[model samples]
Target: MAITTDKMEGTVKKELHVFYVLDTSGSMSGAPIGALNDAMRSTVEELRKKDGEKADLRIAVLEYNSANRWVTQGNNGVENLQDFFWTDLQATGLTYLGGALKELNTSLSRNEKMKAETGNKVPVVIFMSDGYPNDDWQEGLQVLAENKWYRAAIKIAFALGDQADTEVLAKVVGVTKQGQIVPNYEAVIKTNDLQAFSNMIQVVSVSASLAASSSQMLGTEVGAETIVREAAGEGANTDENGVVIVDATSAGGDIYASDATADDLDGFDVI
Candidate 1:
């Protein structure tokens, strides 16, 4: 008889935490909320199949409306992807996005939520919103900026519809090491179609997980920037239904690219 062991034992797996900062304001009620709930359930199912030797995938969800709340904080503030469950969210009240940002800042700290003794990768944060914030979002963002974990995390944002504040979403996702807002590097994806919105959530979640779980050599570009570039690249323009996936020109110029010239991005609009 042959015996095979799954592991030698005493091995600590590297952890890759993914946070979904969702908006559940009154504006997201009706069809929007239904689509969001369905999308989140499917997204979680997809993530379950992504755990690998490089990193053990974990997930956290924070939803905001009149207040912010965590859906997966029962077990050390994060749960393994395979064990996580998606509960359908109800939408109502004001869009207090600023308070959500501050809440996330607290969770991202080493002492509070992320207290792993070994092998901790930079977290991936996905923010989604459909309307303007009703609170002091700028101050909340400013507070989050001071956290080393937030500064290093891979950040992406989604403008759900025409009513969404893309410029504010851009600022939320695109903060340079020097504390500058380079809109191009922000990865603010916009889609008005509900199906397209669902597709984008899956695409970005998978792409970012693949990137963040891999090992990067020294001086490599940020994972979020690479995700945006590939998403906006030529020939990858639309989803299966032919809805435009990303508008690179409007997204901003390449970040940390030395060969990029002013003429190459002449007509691009930043915002």
Candidate 2:
């Protein structure tokens, strides 16, 4: 639950940061918020699963609804999150996506230079919504694209239902990759299923934690493990036991790292 030791010293530590930007507008009142909550709770459960060492992760969230009331708006809103565990947020106000994003950009860009020399990587952003911008969001998106803050972090956008602007979501995805600015983004269009959306974010969070850990082992200064819970699943962690050897795989022409080299995930089907 805390940063114990420095895996790498005197280097720029790469870190994985994710921001769950939820739209609490009018439409997301019933099923949407409910599903979001369940999925979020499950995500926390899964990510806490141990794989040898706890995967370091720093997560924050922004809940924007009712042009007047922003249900959530903290890059690291876990303090509030711990007190509440549901995602079915109410939809009340006009979506101030631009204002919300500007808040996020400012939060990420605050100590930009400190990360460069210290190896702090940029945080990833997951923009989830069911409709187009009700406010001036173009500028906020533009700042994200043009500003060179934590470019190493990823920025993803998901449209919960059919109401999202496909073009915009795709464009933002590519623009947010670290080092290499990814101008092409791939967003999931099935917003009706908040369970699946939450699932994807869960995988992303854990994977990013692994990537961040790898970067730290290589010696960089990303975040110093704000909080890392032990394995939270029922079955003991097979990955962390060391009995399950993690070796690089080279099947066909594809190559995978030792830690996540899965030729096939036994139980689930990849969609």
Per-candidate clashes come to 1, 29
Flag regions of model 2 displaced more than 4 Å: 1-15, 50-55, 67-88, 110-119, 176-191, 212-271
Look at candidate 1 and tell me the lDDT of residue 70.
Answer: 92
In order, the Cα lDDT scores of the candidates are 0.77, 0.49
What stretches of model 1 exceed 4 Å from their correct place? 1-12, 181-186, 213-222, 232-271
TM-score of 1: 0.80
For residues 1-271, what per-residue lDDT tens digits would candidate 2 score against the true structure?
Answer: 5665675454334434456777878777788777677766775565546222532344566777645333343333432223334444556766778777676666665463123233444555666777777877777667766656535555555567657664555555545434333334222323334554565456545554564444344433342111111111122112221111111131111122222434455335545
Q: In model 1, what are the clashing residue pairs, if there are any?
A: 184-252
Give me the overall lDDT of model 1: 0.77
